[model samples]
Target: MLRRNPIDFFNLIWSDEAVQKISKNTDLITRSKIEQNQENLKPHSRLRKWSSPSKADIRRLMGIVISMGVIRLPSITDYWSSNNVLCIPFFREVISRDKFWNLHVADPLPDNVSYPSKSYKIQWLLDHVNMRSQELYEMGQNIAVDETMVKFKGRIGFRQYNPKKPTKWGMKLFTLADSNTSYMWQQNLYVGADGRETELSKCAQHVLDLVEPLSNLSHTVYADRYFWTLGLAQRLIDSGFNINGTVMPNRKGFPQRLKSAKHMKPGEIIAFRKDDILMLQWKDNRVVTMITNNCRSDEWCTIKPKNPNHDTRNKPKCIADYNKHMNGVDVNDQLCTYYL
Candidate 1:
C-alpha cells in the first residue's frame, strides 16, 4: 500500500462503488439545500448553484480533507482568504470553501434511513472502508482491543464524554488493532444501550463483537480491566483464542483473599487456578487482579525501571507481555491526536 500511487491508494479506501453513490447523494443534498434556501430568500439573498461532483472532484475533495489535518489555521475561511499570509493556494486550486462545505454530506435520504439508529448516517461509508482494510492486509499474531475517541464537538446523538481520554469528548469506539503495526482490523461505534439480552456489561459485549470474528486464528487478544472478565476468558479459550488482561479486584468470582490483598507489598504475587484459567493478583503500585488462559503466572522475568532512581525488580512474564503488546490502540490514538 505504501508503494501504491496516490490515486491507487485513494481507491483502496474510496472504491468506485462508494465514489459513485456519494457523488449522486452530494448532488441531491446540494439541490435540496439550495431549494430550501430559495424559499426563505430575501431581496439581497443569492441562491447557491448546484452541480453533481465528478469522480475526480470527490478524490480532490478528500485529498484536501487529509491535507487540512496536516495544515490548519484559526478558521475554515482563512484557508481561502485573499490575505496572502492565511491563504493556502492548494485548497482554492482544488475547490472553493463554500463548495467543500456544501458537498460534505453523503448521508442516506430520509426515506431510506433507519429510525432509532445511532450509526446509520456514516455506517455505509465505514463499511466500505472496513471491508477494504481487511482485503488490503493481514493482521499480526497479537491483537489489542480497546477504546478510542474521535474529537467531535457537535450536536449529535451517541456522542461520548470520557474525562480520562486525551480526546474526552467525541465519538467513542471499540477497536481491535494489530499489536505490531497498530493497524485497525475492525471497530464498532459505541451506541448507548444495544437493547439486547446479555449477561455481560455493554463494554464486555463490545469486546465480544470485535473479537468473535477473529476466533480459531490462534490470536492472543489483550485488553484492560474495563473490558475483560472470567467469563470472557473462558469463552475465548473455548473458541481457540487466548485472553490476558487486568481485572478489577472487586469483580464477581474474584478470590476473597485477593479483594483485600492491598497489604501485599510491591512485587508480591499470588494466583489461583480453575482448570486452564489462572487468576493472578500481582502487586505493583496497586494490587492488580488479572484473569488469563494463556499466560504463566508462575514464571517471572527481570524488570529494569526506566527511571534511574528506581531499583530493578522481578516481574511476572504475563505482565511483561501485556505491557509490551497492549498499547497498539493508544499508539494509533496518539497519531490521530497529532493530526487533530
Candidate 2:
C-alpha cells in the first residue's frame, strides 16, 4: 500500500480554544481603549461608539497585512487613494483603517489565572506557528541552523539589534531549515541570551531542538562558525548525527597545535581526529579551520575561483559541502526580502 505524505498527514495543531482566547483578549483591549477615550471626551463633543472585533475580523486584519506586503503601498490608506491599486475592487469593505490601526492580539495582564507571568504578548501565536511549521513537514537529511531577524523597530523588551543583518533592528529568530529546499522545519524566538547556558551550549541546544524529530535518523547537520564547537560535534556524533561546520580558533576544546601557523602549499591539510570527531585546518590564501563528525578530513576537492584568471584552489571535501549547504538560511532570508 502507498503511504500518505507526512506533510498531508499532519493537521493544524493551532487550537480553536487558543484562537478564542486571543480574540477575546483583543476585543477586551480595543473596547477598553475606546471607553477610556470616551470618558476623556469634552462635554459637547460627540463620542464615536464602536463594537469589538470578532475572530473573523482579526483574520481579515491579518490578511490585510499580508496584502500590504504584496501591494507595497506607502501607507494603509494608500490602497484607497493611490492610483496604482485603484483598479482593484473591494478595497475598503474588507478592512477599514480604523479596524487595522486598533487591532490587538492580547490584553496586558500580570500573572493572572488566565495569563502566565512569563508568557509574552504574542506567545500564543508564536507557539502555534512553531508547532504547525514543524508538524507539516519532515526534515531532509541535510539541515542547517541559523538566525533570521523579523523587522520590528517598535518598543519591545525582547527586540534585538544586529548591525550585520539586513534588518538590523527587529526580533531575533533562530531557525532550523532543510538545506536542499530551504524549508523551515523549526524555529524559536531568541528571547535574549540566557545567562545559565554558555554561548556554545545555547547554539547546540537550538540545533538539537530543531532536529529533535530526526535525532536517530543518521542525518548530517551544517552550521556556521557561531554554532559549531568541538563539544557540540562530539555530542551530536554520540546521538547518531553527523555534523560539519566552520570553527573559530578561540573556541573551547580547539587544539592549540592546530592553531600554529605553518608555511604550507594549497591543498595541504592537517587533520586531528578523536574517535568519530575530526578537526581539519586547510591552507589556501589563509588557513580555514573546520570540524566535522563523519567526514574524512583528508579528502580534498578542486575549487575554481569566481575570477577566471585566478588559479583554481583546493578545498577540503567538508568545506566544499559546508559552503554548499550553509546557504539554506541565507537563501530563505533572500526569498523573504524579495517578498517584502
Candidate 3:
C-alpha cells in the first residue's frame, strides 16, 4: 500500500467499507429527518430534493468537501456563486450547495436520543482511519506521541480549552505519529472524564494503546511534558520501549539540584541517572530539562553552522535527537491547517 504514490494510495487508507458506511448512514439519516419534517407538516425541500446517494456519489461528495478546504472562499455559500471570481465551476457541475449539505455524513446518527459516545458522530470514521493507518504502514523504530486540537467551537461535552494551542478551543486528541515520515498511526479522542483517571494516569494508558503491537519492539517514543512523567518513563523502559521527552517544570520527580542548575553558563550540560532512567538538564539561553532512557546522558553533538563565518556550537546529542524525533504530530498539524 505504501508503494502507491500520491493520492492513489488514499483509497487503501480510507478503504471501501468506511466509504460505504458513510453512504448508507447519510441515506438513513437524511431520509429519517425528511420524514420527521413531513410528519410535522413541514416539508424539507422547497428546492431540489435529496435522493439517496450511492457509494460513488458519497465519494464525489467527499472530494468536493476536501476541495472546498483547499480552495477557500469567504463563506460556504460562495462555492456556488456565479460571479467570475467566486464561482468554482466544477462544484456547480457536481452538486448544488443544498444537495451537498443533505448528503454529507461520515458516521451514523444514534437511533435513540441516548448518546453511545461523545464522538459518535464521526467515531466510525476515526476507528476506520486509525485501523487502516497502522495496518497499511509500519512506523519506524522511533515514534512520537502528542496531543492535537481539532478546532470546534460548538457546544460539546469534551471540548477542550488549551491556551497554548493555535486553535485554542476545540476537541482534543491523543495522537501517535511516525517520527520518520510524519504519518499519524493511531489516535484516541479525549472524551473528558470517563472515571477516576487523572490526566497524568491517562497519559500512561494513551501511550500503551497508541503503540499497540509496537510494545516490546524497542521502539523509541517521544512526548512533550503534557504526557511525559518520570515514573511512566521508567515503566515504559521496563516494557521494552525507550522514552525521550521534555520534562514538565514541576516538583513531581525532578531533582531539586538540577532545578538550580539554571545558574550554569550557556551551553553547559548536566545529567543524573536513576536506575534505568537518565535525567538531563542542559543550559542554553535558559535551562532546558529532559528525561530519557535511550541515549547517553553525557553524549554531545557538534552543530556546524552552514555559514563558515558563524561559529559552530556543541549541543547535547540527547537534545538534538529529542527535537528531531518529536515533531511528527506538529508537522502533521501544520500540514492539516496550511495545506488542507
Candidate 4:
C-alpha cells in the first residue's frame, strides 16, 4: 500500500466548515466578479432546451471560487479541488490570472498562461517599504549606513571588452535603523563604482538623500573614518545633528616642541601646556592625553593608565616616542578636546 500524502489530510481539514469559518471570514459571493458577470451574460432566447443551473450547481461553483480565493495560493490545490485554481485573494478582491492578464500583462499574452507583469508588483512593494521607513523615522531613531559588493554572473574579461565589468554589479546599501528599538527604518540600494574619492563622494550623497527626510527626529548617523570627512562633519553639525563617531586623523601636521620632552618618563606628565591638559605615557607602551572642557588639573589626575609598563619593548613609549612611532598620534587628546 502507498502512503497517503500529508497535504491530502490538510485538504480535508481545510474544507471543513469550522476551519473555513476560522480561516476565512469573507462571504464567497462578495469574493469575486465572476458571479456578477455570470448574471449579466445574456442567453439566446431561441435555445429552448437550456436551463439555469440548479441551486446545488450554484453552490458548487461558489465553493470553487471560494477555494481559489480564500485559500492561500501556496496551499490552494490542497484546500480546494477545482479546475480554475489560479486566483488569489488579496486586498479584499480575487485576483485571477485571466483578469490580471487582461488588465496589465503584455500584449499577445503567451500561449502558456502566466501571472501578471512583475514590474508593477516590484514598484508596489518598493512603495510599501518606503512608507514603512517613513513611519519608523518619525519615531526617533538612529540610522547606520553601509555598503557591500555583488558580483555579476556574466563575464567579458579584465582590460578586455567584458560585459561583466559594465553589467556585473555591486551595490551600496543605506540602512536606517532605530537604536533603541532595534528596528530597521529604511534601505536604499545603489550601484557600486571605482574606489576613487569622487565616486565614493557620490555614493555618500545618495545615502544622505535617504537620511535627510528624517532630520526632524532625534536621529544620529554612525559611520567609519572614511565616511567622516571634515566637510561632511561640518555639514552634519550645521544641520543641528550630534555626531559621535571616530574623528578622522589629520594627514599633515607639525611636531610639537616641549622644553622638558627629554626628561619625560613613561607614565609621567611632561607638561600641562596652555590648555588644561595632561599628557601621560607608560613603559608598557600605552600613551594617552587627557583633556577636559572644565580645564582643571584634578580632571587629569583622575585618569589612570591601563598599562603601567611604558618603557618595556612590548609597550608604547613616551609621548615623544609615540609621536615617532605612530603615524597619526601627533594631535594629542588635549589638542582635540581644546579645538572641538
Candidate achieving the largest TM-score: 1
How high is each candidate's TM-score? 0.93, 0.82, 0.91, 0.35
| CA error at residue 293 for candidate 2, angstroms | 1.5
Better by TM-score, candidate 4 or 1: 1
lDDT (10s digit) by residue, model 4, range 1-340: 9889965643433334433332232223222323445556456321222233333333343445555444445643333224345533341243333222222111222235563433222333344556655653454434454432223333422111223322234332445554445344565544333344542266456556656776645455654434544445445545555443322233112124331245455655422333222222222233233211122332222223458864323322222222222221112212322322
Q: Write the per-residue lDDT of candidate 2 for residues 19-121, one digit (tens) a residue.
A: 5666788777766565677767666432243466677776676567657777775566677563654534455778765566667766556334463323367
* Global Cα RMSD, each model: 2.3, 4.5, 2.5, 18.5
Alpha-carbon local distance difference test for all models: 0.81, 0.75, 0.81, 0.38
Clashes of each: 0, 0, 0, 11
Q: Which stretches of candidate 2 lie over 4 Å from their true place?
A: 1-22, 35-38, 41-48, 80-90, 107-119, 195-200, 262-264, 302-313
* Candidate 3: clashing residue pairs, number: 0
lDDT of 4 at 317: 25
- Sorted on lDDT, best first, the list reads 1, 3, 2, 4
In candidate 4, where is summed lDDT lowest over 10 consecutive residues? 325-334
lDDT of 1 by residue, 1-340 (tens): 3576777766777787788877878888777767767767666432344567887788777788778889988887787888978877989998877677766545746655566577776777777777788888788889999998999999888999999987889999898899999988787888789789988778888988888877799999899999877777777888888878888877777779878896898878899998898889888887777777777878888889899899898888888888889999999888877768
Off by over 4 Å in 4: 1-124, 148-171, 192-200, 247-340
Report clash pairs, candidate 3.
none
lDDT of 2: 0.75
